[model samples]
Target: MTTTANTSHNIVFLDRDSLIANVRRPAFSHSWTEYGATAASEAAGRLAGASIAITNKVPLRADTLAQLPDLKMIAVAATGTDIIDLAACKERGIVVSNIRDYAYASLPEHTFALILALRRNLLAYRADVQAGQWQKSDKFCLFDYPITDLAGSKLGLLGYGALGHAVARLGRAFGMDILVHKRTPVEEEGIRSVSWDELLETSDVLSLHAPLNEQTRNIIGSTELARMKRSALLINTARGGLVDEAALAAALTTGIIAGAGFDVLVKEPPPEDNVLLNLHLPNFILTPHIAWASTQAMQILADQLVDNVEAFVANKPVNVVG
Candidate 1:
């Protein structure tokens, strides 16, 4: 592979600190500039003469893209390209490439981590043990919380993509029967998918792997949650906006669903008043979107990120996103 990109190329990495991996210097010589984190206000200025721009979460809308006439390509550090204005990039003839499958190992593992913890009531038991519930029980064991085995239970998967497939494999190992729905109009011929209603009604554990878009935003709300079995568990490691955080908070309080495990939320570092943040229920577990941040996974992502840049400069872009 050709190393350093075009020598005259000016590359600006907007958020170098997002990845925990050590990014190697490009093979082709180029002037490189990076920032630990960048605000939208500082984006265009920092990208003044940059031939290439790299960003993880920073949004590059049409207005911002309009100013970067020198930009030839954008190397998105993550898989999701919603942050970039793809139409504007296409209009300007700028290439946009994003990393994919880098988190296959880490993401599914994290999903199961949350699933096992919630199903077995790991946190509640641990909290009770620390609070001296075991000592106060005066017995050999304490059955303070419910424990549900994953084996023989049904798993409702909203997506059947890479991450979803991996999670399904793991679920089968634990003896789970997977049920998935086909929401899009186009799918493989001859195969039928379950309806959304059936998936919600029959699922013992409903896991979401779908992205956040107009058709999917807040797909799981009060009505959807109400359709699920009272013992059903909900898991979301995909996008947070796919779920209604307010409804989820209400569900946990009123037992709309048995438990939930989420790694993403509608807002990152959500405002202090986010309802989900205020809920103190052990059944409602929330993580700050670390499902894909395993150190090894980040390393693979960083390596591919540079690889995309190198290939683009070579006049053969890979992983181009629409």
Candidate 2:
């Protein structure tokens, strides 16, 4: 653990509006300053005199950290720490902690929501209904969109952590077979362990639950997408960079696979030129990275964020990551 010389600390929350829950002050002698949002240029200025920094999506790169000599610790408001430079923090003796297992319920539910929506062609059918296609139909029902059942279909999970386990349980409830490819060995019953190639080729629905990192970034590119079944559905509730945005846009346009549902994008608040943003396919669903932002889940995350901060101040930091 990195120890600070100061008796009291200055804590600054860089992006307070990212979280929708109440963040109670830490149980220590510290000054707290919060901003609704922080841009890249404003980061160094906001965190100038701070000993501790709280951030959700704001980037704390090597250059920004170099300016904040007083920074002793970084309390990440979310699980993903890619926004902060871990190597830089390690070299500076800055303790970096992140929230863990906070989105177990909301994440899995959202993943399945995407899966079910794509499988049943819910969005396509909804658009048809809104366009009065159902009203103009001669038959009792409209079958313009092909609907598939989740039962007996294979559910492939990329990373089998707490979130993966929760998703597998839901798949089972929906009568879907579970197949997983994870770094660790599979020890759970009824879950079949498969190679990366087999998982890609076999699953009816391939869901990503892995964190964004060097090895996992752009893991699902053109070749990986081509390996999947033409009827397969791609679901990504995890990080956006896991799939190449241009490649995904091409795949969706070319019909390499059936469809996709994503809660994240490579660049959040994506620019006008983003390929995925320009795609107007009914099969492709792009949610604004709110898979883990349910009211219940945000409160859990908010409570845990304070816990991480409190633990670090007491010299017993939990969820301490790179």
Candidate 2 structure, TM-score to reference: 0.96
How many angstroms is residue 73 displaced in model 2 relative to the true structure, after the best TM-score fit?
0.5
lDDT of 1 at 276: 88
Q: Model 2 off-target regions past 4 Å?
A: 1-7
Tell me the tens digit of each residue's lDDT in model 2 across 1-322: 1222334888889888889998887889888888889998899999988989999989999999999999999999998999999999999999999998989999999999998888889989999999999999999999898899999999999999899999999999999999999887698899999999999999999999999999999999999999999999999998999999888889989999999999999988999999999899999999999999899999999999999989988999999996
User: Per-residue error at 137 for model 2, in Å?
Assistant: 1.9
Model 2 CA RMSD to the hidden true structure, in angstroms: 3.3
Q: After superposition, how far is residue 62 of candidate 1 from its true place, in Å?
A: 1.1
Report the C-alpha displacement of residue 76, candidate 2, in angstroms: 0.5
Which candidate gets the maximum TM-score versus the true structure?
2
Residue 189 in candidate 1, Cα distance off native in Å: 16
lDDT of each: 0.89, 0.92
